[model samples]
Target: MHSGMTDVTFQLRYGSNLTYECSLAADRVVASHLPPPALTDLPARLSEALAAPLEFPALHQAIVPGDNVTIVLERDTPQAGALLAAVWKEIASRGVAPDHLTVLQPASYRSQPPTDPRDALPADVREHVTWKVHEPATEVECAYLASTAAGERIYLAREAVEADFVLTVGELAFDTLLGYRGTSSSLYPGLSTAEALRRSHGQGHDELSPDDQRPLRELTDEIHWLLGGQFSLQVIAADGQNVSAVVAGQADAVLRHGKKLLAETWRFEVPARPELVLVAVEADAGGHHWSQVAAALDAARHIVARDGRIVLLSELEEEATDGILMIRDARTPRDALQPLRQAAPADLIAATQLARTIDWANVYLLSRQDHDLVEDLFMIPLEDENEVDRILDGDEPCAVIGGGQHTLTHLQNR
Candidate 1:
């Protein structure tokens, strides 16, 4: 695909508030993909979605005067605080007292520390709302749900299980484990017991298919059913902190709507495998981490040629995990990955993905970490845009992918 210009300049997003610009030969560019323009009035769109949700009652109609409500949030989602504020205001307007509403969130939405979702609320509203982070390892924090089809016992956060109404707020995007991230995903493995969480971590969907019938998604739906979760709010994000769309209402309806919008916004098709795939992983507020980098690399690997080069640009600063440390100390990638296959840890997928990506292509990572740590992972450390400029100076076919963490690239001839 020709970029239609002699020299194409790209202002790529990096870190929280920085952008790195570079130029590429238009003829050498095989493809370029970016998210659609962000919505100009996000708050109004959110309010409209809540007021007229699909296949479910509006917020005022859904909640009664005395119902105890719990909002389960996927805290790492872009603009999560905005979503929470919109939902909370609608529910509170229905005469539901502040004490009866609780915000239950996962301990760590990403590899880095999370900003409290409730912080988006006004000071008065923030003071009255109850908030707690889910702790998967603590027995006291969980309540027994039903058993799965396999008869494996299921446990979720006590707050979510016991609430009279549960409203799930999560991001809708392609996922390695769940095919596509559904509303229920944030509640089950995210808020479930440590055992369930570990089991979920072990089930990596290497096939990368978006079929709705995948086992993990089925499990998530079943868990949502067991919890009597009927209403949900899901967001599809644009590049960086921008949100492209928001869907609200009945779980299935929201999932259906979200899936369609996700495909239109994030999926891309290339003509052929490029020799070099340049990708940018953006997290607006300092939340960029190793897991997102892994996701971006995984996306790039699908569209790059054998022994091709993948340059990943991010502002990753999260500390190394135990799995990462294992990789750092191992003699070979296989040795580092062998132990992870038995027991799933926090960084199981990330560690394995990084090792596999390096084995397939040369990965250049530009991040805030030290050169020693970058070398430890067998990745070449990228210091500045000069290195990027040097790489682009090659005449090989290249593809530039924006928001690679949420992107799904397919070769047209494949």
Candidate 2:
């Protein structure tokens, strides 16, 4: 139980089955249910999926055997290597020469920085497959038309769009943009020129109302339409540990399958009534944005009690969430409103959606950096480990849920 109005603990649990103790406070709970582990037998699965003889004569004949095929892969994620390897094997067996294959990654965004070289592709595939990286255009300008009427002008990597056949592989996760990311993403945001993407992506940061479709679904659809049927997509949905439950082929089929799977895997059960609840953000998963932290918070709120306390754990790498400037300026929702209103209307809209999703009174964050920033922006205190420990040592009937380091173990002990 919370000793004071502001006091709470963070606990972690996994899949509603296993519980663990974490360094967080006793009243706070964290859920650490990682996506299912990567599917080790992916290659075999891909082989089985492709075993049927080719129906189209055009697909049967390779232009230059195995060496000339072009395969585009998404960046990040531990499963990338396995996914690519499976594609490679499938193509090679179909008579595409190994030397002909080229793997392409989507252009980097300003908000999402590049991955470390160490975490990049393995040497064998790196040596054989040509690599191309695209960055946003420096000189591009953003035009804000309306709530959902922003446009982007990006420079797409020519090789990616020019390929006779482009295969995009990735896991489908809920996104503020395009509803989901996979086939549609690979085409517009993935392969578009930097200028196009910049013009298009700029509006996502604008401030507007929830009813307005400006930054979210509308823009994603616009980008999707612009791709013009240049590439095919393969999307997979994984459990807590990234295990594939559904594999979809073709653009439409893949997207549909991914959406269904997302609905199934992303759901959490909530209690009808409870006095308190705790939530924490995983350092490894959350991308350091308060918005990213908000994603976890949104998941936790679904199951939290009406008057529950939700504590969020985040290592503040940057002041703003999702690279938007206004979010960094204010710590609490009330404090954020002025800056948000002062910003461009589009910016205000995006910020507003974030504000609506989070419960200002119930949220808290524990972080090493910018504790004051979080407090000022979200109205949530930044608590030290000592404070959390003190609360945990006290007597309170607390139920913890959500994810954080050692959170599961802590909950079990409680």
Candidate 3:
């Protein structure tokens, strides 16, 4: 903002709510803002959704005694404690033995002392069920299946590929590149090797395009077919981890429900573009990744004008993703993208998306990282807290996004 009010304070969402108190002209331009709906009646609502899964057996009827059932979870799944408890209770009521259950994580980079998923289960269930993480880089962990028309080799954990029934429970959100995320994604690209992922991803899709008519639907539907899945439970959230809705059934059906919720709640429509936008990430510790930052930026771009600037409010505690950290040594945005794609090691999606955002607009990062490292990636780093005041002193307009990482922002007119 070129010239604003006397004092201004914004509770920027970074992991937890970070109070961004600034001295703005009292008359600051608050262009547009939108928050998610209330997350009430979650348990009842989830049960209702499961009650009517599209073209699938009831949760209890589908499972039987002595049946080996594999439950896949995305690393990013939230409120997992509740989902795990619900799944176990439902299946147990159906007479399924805990010993017949297996929990697989295809993209989890767990710590040396992996947090036990069993801790979330009941005492009896914990003793019988098995929980394992899959490493896609290792052939022992990932088995090759078929190839897509795009030649994207389909590779997944052997357990999931050979399972009698493949089921997944995770939260699905609108992805800037992939359209909508859910079960099929949790299995295919989420479970595939780094090389396979590179092929699965093509040039970015037009996000502003109507999501319901997008081609990603067909692609995810095909993946659902390949998986031969029993059911996939997708979650919706209001604010952080406040799961409001749960949709289960086939993959495409899950995706459809998730998209519908996104259109109604997560997606925000703004009247016009702004020259300066401040995007912040205030979710959980998991939201510290570069992918989260990229998503926040992707949301901001919809309401940001050409040649405008974006103030990225990310502590970047997770730093750049393992694959994208090399950008810190690169000299320019072009340099970052070329070598990054050629590397194609891991986190290629996030690394590539970030590099593209840097090239798209003037981005100023509000982070705790080394200034030189931030600048190496062609982004301006505001190491000093007072820098925000200087920017606000200007007369230019600005907008603040409290839930940038999770909110689906779009222009109403565009």
Candidate 4:
């Protein structure tokens, strides 16, 4: 804590680069931790991993002539631009025209695609390729696939299923539903119909370990088994942009290798469980989506004391605020969870999980979202940024979380 004339000055990041200055007592400022430093030479690292993928043939050997290749990417994966450029250069050398390639990003269920395809691809290569937003929520856009053992109808995006070649690029992070975001999982929950997406995601709703694997992995296995020759490129990314480590090839193999790299980079050892957890949700586009807020709470769980306080700062700019409304409407956290268990509402899985966290801790949030709406969810709302300390009310030894969605805090002695 830095010294101030009247009070201690704590300058903390409220958004990506925006700062929040709070004045509190020096003793109350218990601890501060920064995120892991970024990896150097990101492009070369991505190129190297793509050049020699584990458990799969090299890029050229994998893609043959006349193949209609589809590259799956999430909205947040700008690094896909680099991965695509590298792969495209290789494919082009072997006479694979750019017209034969399609870049697919999972569309938000029941809505139009969230991002412009041009924004996700490299400028040099963007013009030469085709881009499609995979819409599993749309009836015509999906096809009838085999149902799960649980009897959930499996409808997959037709483009991804019908494509002659599939290569997915995504970063590894702690996912609230599936343990981690691997390549296979991207196909579904984004490319599946609304019912299938909700059913699969709602399966895991408790404290999810990074190592726990079940339905998601099993589902991935079945999908690959049914539709052979699927390839994945997984990354351990810092700040969601810089690629440090990468693993590619078979989705299961990529999942295994990516998890190891992910644990090393994203996990941190905190000295003690803090009385207060302050998490800043960076203000990227769609940064404050319900899933992201829930993920931040998940990261906080690793270091927050039982019944402690958690403060979040985010823009909450996503079009939907259903989760917040769900929390507000329920009489208690348990009441809110019942519907999520029965019917998963797209990516709003966070509302159910966030309610559970609220049951354990008092969460305070700062967002552009409606204050009444924020308060209706049983969380304390911070009106002004500077009032962070005032709301903290001298709760000392607070833990401030940056990159809340992408970070995991582990206890040093636990």
Candidate 5:
């Protein structure tokens, strides 16, 4: 789109305020996707969004006195403590006793000690709010919900099942399994029984496009509807540590608005398929990891030419997950993925997407990981920007994707 310029400069980011820059011939650049500016006053916007929700009553009006409310909190959400504090303060102000309000944490956080969102609240408010982590394996912690039309039995976290009102606070972003993740995405496998979790997420090859109708997503929606409480609050991420917008309303309405806002904020369309794609991944709170890299590669693979090159740029330092390790130790990707089809581990989806992408295209990595580890995973290790510059110097069309983990990039025709 640069009519006159011969080259365009790109400043890729990772970690807080860290950046890497390179220039490409203007004609060679086919697409560039970047996150929108972060919201300046999140608290004020949150207050306003909660006050006037879409297709639903205000949060305060929806609750009555003596109601036992459960707030399902997404632990990784940006400024989660503040979001939880705001929601809890509103519920408390409406005469709901602190003891009657429960904060239900996801099961994935059980391995590590998670920070208490109550810490962000005022001293008096923080003292009385009850918090419980979801235990899917314990029969006492889960209660029978309804069976699906397909005869699948469902069990939800006892806290949500027993609560008079349920409020889900989560983020809206692209998912490897579900097209768009938010709303009830956290409730199904997140708060359900271990069997349900495995059944829902154990698929190794059920990747869905953002616009496709995914059975997993449909099932999650059914769970949300069956659970009864409709109030939902979802945030659209702006970058690593900030959100661009917060949508609160009926579950369906909030999901619709959130999806629309997400596309407007993160979608990028290229005129045609490109031969080279450079993706930058990062998270400010904790360093980067493999899941983010996998998501970025998935997005890149969508609009990349056959046998194209995808270079993942990050400062990733975490050790590879069990699924990734399985890939490294196996003779072939299919051989490694066979076990995941039966038992979905924490990084199953990420590992599957990564292995598939490695098969589809050439994947290069620039991270803190050891060169041997990167090679074992079948990715070329990128030494420096000089290497990236050398690749860009080639005469093929290329693309740049920022916040690639959160971005959704595709061709205009497809």
Candidate 6:
């Protein structure tokens, strides 16, 4: 109990009367509050935003009267079914028969099987469209080796490069590797051959820097450029619940709108100084996993007074970018950079960029994983609820933000 207040719970109220509650005793509550909403009311908001008729050039249209158009959906997207429904509605309104469209999803990496594709797509559309499950290529034997005056081995994804028209539907959030995930992400890592992914992942980890052209961004840009040159694209951005506010055409235009919306929704305000900060990662939402780490670090860097402590809470259901799982175990900011630097080539690209750009060392963490590892890497002890109470009692006031498994609560000497 904190300060003799034995029963402590965090209450969140949404849309005036809708409320959700969680016990504060848990390491991560999976629910909390932030100053600004991410895409909280996605369904309602996106329906309203997309209600108007979309305007596309005649040349830009890919679905001809009888053309079989394939829709490539991203796995991490929140509400694939809802988004597909909206797209289908739009397509139908454009006079394209439901039978002319096809639906496809990427294969899963985790033990948990992917959602049934039939459940996500409408029955009518499902009947008409052929469902293709594209797994990442196991053996990428074909590598485009180029030898010029200055020889450099450049490998590209044949399948991704050959797609007729690829439409990417997903949320826009801060990613550890790519500043954001959407658009061309489906091309390189999503549809690209395994070898290309390995090459990109390896190279990204090795040569990644603090610059704008870091591996993830560079690769994303390359895929985007190629896709734009080859085929047409339809990009959508939604609020927290997968409600889309903006539907953009072309690779550049879509990414631009997405970045703007992400900046508005994801950016948080920071007090000049704070003593302690807390961040939580929701267990069910995989998309928010790494983004939560990035967000936790961002918030920690902003509010914590020099030498102040911060805590991160997460279940870590998803793997770390580039497989650098020991980031939580870093003893100091400097100490963390080395292992991140030594990461495999692809992993290094994303990890080094995140290390250089994000300030993570100031924070502590409370999680289900190895607490000692976290302490060794970040040099901050992971605390139980009782320990948190003691720390809160000694220091200043605390403020909490976040929702789902990734929650943030902080105690600061104000």
Compare the candidates by TM-score and give the number of the best one.
1
Alpha-carbon shift of residue 20 in model 5 (angstroms): 1.1
Cα misplacement distance, residue 212 of candidate 5 (Å): 2.3
Put down candidate 1 lDDT per residue, 1-414, tens digits, no spaces: 123448788777867777778788788889888766787898999999999999987877989888999999886777888898898789888888878889888764245556777789888778888988888878999989888788878888899989999999988888777788859888878888777776667536676568736777888888899889999998888878888888999999999888889778998889989999999888843267777788889889888998999999888888888777777888866677777776566778787777677878998988888889989888899998788778778899999988888898778966
lDDT of 6 by residue, 310-384 (tens): 655554434545434545456545466767655553345434433532353355555444556544444455545
Residue 352 lDDT in candidate 6: 47
- Provide TM-scores for the models: 0.93, 0.65, 0.82, 0.82, 0.93, 0.65
Q: Give the Cα lDDT of each candidate.
A: 0.83, 0.47, 0.68, 0.69, 0.81, 0.48
**Where is the poorest 10-residue window by lDDT in model 3?**
107-116
What does candidate 2's lDDT look like per residue over 1-414, in tens digits? 223454542234332233334443433433323333346676666545444212212222333353355555565433556556656656656666545666666664534643432223445645656655554353232222223234344335555445555555555665444445555565455455555544445323223322244443444445444433333435343422344543535455556666666555543333242334445544332134444455555444444555465555555455554323455554644455556554433333345544543443366665565666555455455566555444445443444544422111212211
In model 2, what is the error at residue 404, expressed in angstroms?
9.6
lDDT of 3 by residue, 1-414 (tens): 223346455554455556565444444454545346545776666676566777676787787766788888766666666677777777788777888888887653333223456677878679889898776677787776666677755667888877777788877877655677677767765576765555665435644454645555456557667767759887876555566577888766777667887787777776667778877665542556676777777777767777688887767756556556766667666577777767764576666667667767788888777787778777889865578656656767667776677777777766
Q: For every model in order, what is the number of clashing pairs?
A: 0, 74, 18, 1, 0, 38
Tens-place lDDT digits, model 5, residues 303-399: 8888899988887777888788878987866677777655566788788878777877888888888999989988898887677677667888888
Query: Ten consecutive residues with minimal summed lDDT in candidate 5?
Result: 200-209
RMSD of 4: 4.1
Give the C-alpha miss distance for residue 338 in model 2, angstroms. Answer: 7.0
> Which candidate has the top score in lDDT?
1
Candidate 4, which segments miss by more than 4 Å at Cα? 1-12, 21-33, 110-112, 119-128, 137-155, 240-244, 269-272, 284-286, 317-320, 339-343, 391-395, 409-414
By lDDT, rank the candidates, best first: 1, 5, 4, 3, 6, 2
